[model samples]
Target: MSMAQWVETYGQGTVLAAGGVLIGLSFGFWAQRSRFCLRAAVIEFWHRRFGEKLSVWLLAFASAVIGVQLMVLMGWLDTGSARQISAKGSISGALIGGMLFGVGMVMTRGCASRLLVLSANGNLRALLSGLIFAVTAQAALGGALSPLRTHISSWWTVEGGAPRDLLAIAGVDHWAGLAMGGLWLAAALFFALRSPQRSVWMWLGGMGTGLSVAAAWGFSQWVAAESFDPVQIQGLTFSGPSAEWLMRVMHWPAPPIGFDFGLMPGVFVGSLIGALVGRDWKLEGFSDGYSMRRYIGGAILMGFGSMLAGGCAVGAGVTGGAIFALTAWLSLVGMWVGAGLTDRWLDGGAADKPTSLPAEGFKRP
Candidate 1:
């Protein structure tokens, strides 16, 4: 039976919640295995000669494109569910928020998802970063800075709706988009396969990482449809939900619980369980008082940026990109530029220097 039919026949909550569990498990397993991290990927690209981390991200992106396209073809998910398709005109927000998030990730030494997994590993620094991100995202989304974000976003627009996704832009059908996306995925795999530094499991981990986001999107759609609010579909991301949860005090008539909220909690818990199973759990904290200060500052910046941008790395970067959102592309550019600037600044204006090493116990691939 069709996915919608299945959902209708069974139950929306059951389907969505099950999808969330799938996503949580996928992410927990992939993260535990591959250590996929955007911050580490960017930093390694800038400082170290290692490109393996970056490769993982590309692999994930490619995998996501494939998974999402397949889902669309199967009629399980509408391709338009992506934020990029919906928020095509919000270029200003995407760029500004993306850049800020990139900088924050650099400062905190990890992206939102990475921070979640790291926190599970007993990294006090990551936990602090998550808290700071949660607080700052709250402020930016509904607190004092919300006005600025609203103003900036009002000034930008995208012609012809959101850019046709990879295939549509290329003037091709969904299958074509699938083909193109698959080609990229193949290229990433080829690169990984050829790399002496890469492992089979690492590549699988990367693919799993990307698919987890797709699962989240599918799950989110299921949740939205169940809630009778088809307009509010969204997949996994850290920024907005954290902000919403924080500002729940103000927005009475609380928004109904959806996939993002369910998945977010599931990820944290899944990671914790994964860590424990792997014998990696420990109570940890900042390296020093200075480190704590930097971590907090970074988290706050990330929170603000994510709020303005509408989602964090997973939200804007993965889910946004899959749908071929013009704003999401802008956000990606902003994130890269911001990350580059922050990396340079942290390395004494030289982007080539490695600012910090992997934590003491974590082994570098």
Candidate 2:
């Protein structure tokens, strides 16, 4: 049956949730097998060791840009109404929040999405950090921290619509965007080929991770077009979704069953399956009180920073970057700089330092 028919039969919520499940599953599986982590990528780049980790991240990012731009050119997806473009943005928040998030990820040894993936693989440190991240995100969204986030966001505001669109600011069309993506893809291919540990999973997993982002965009747009009710055109984001799930679990009446409803669980399950298949599932926990404090502190910073910046690493960096959002680009730059500096200061520029829970399936060389 057609998507419209499915929506008519069941509901837009159910259909969106189902699509989220499929896309999230693909993302989780690929991210797990590829060991895709922006923190890892940033460390590799900063340490001047362009290896498998950096290549995988670049491939995923370039692929998402290419896929999303291609879809826009084909008239298959329209992102004009998406929040990343339509909503008011903050320069201060993007910069400050992105930096904080970068620092937090280095401290915790994973970003928000990475934390979730690791949690599903029996990493107790990640599991706890994920919970902390969710709670902090919730607090920033509507709790006590909301006021602080609001004040910072209001410090330097940018008008929505054309002002928030990076492509519009650059006087470039989607074709240019596609070309830029191509250049990035070329660089990724060069690095991937140079890496001695390149494998089929590296290629497929990186592309798959990126395609999942594009697929989410396309699916949500299609749903919005077909559904009678208003539906949010969104891709994968952990901050809002994490807060939503936390509230649902803590409250009585459940929130609406939209894309986020299934996305989290799907990712968790997908990562679990990947771990089992790869025999990478192993129970692990914090080694010391100092480590525990660091993880918690990182989670708190990430939670607040993601909300302040209007997205996390995946949300603002990859998803928003693909669409050429101005604030997202700033945030992405902030993350890279912040992470690099933090690594230099804290870890002494050692990217290969062992974490409390090393990414088991894929090791950094």
lDDT of 2 by residue, 23-91 (tens): 889999999888888998898899888888889999999999999999999998887788999988999
**Which candidate should be chosen as best, given TM-score against the real structure?**
2
Report the Cα lDDT for residue 183, model 1: 85
Report every candidate's CA lDDT. Answer: 0.72, 0.90
Cα lDDT tens digits, model 1, 134-220, are 877776676777888788877875643426354566676778767867887777776576656787657887898888888777767
TM-score of 2: 0.97
Task: Output the lDDT of residue 188, model 2.
Answer: 92
Candidate 2 wrongly placed segments (more than 4 Å): 352-364
Candidate 1 global TM-score: 0.86
Q: lDDT: which candidate is best?
A: 2
- Spell out the clash pairs found in candidate 1: 84-325
Clashes of 1: 1
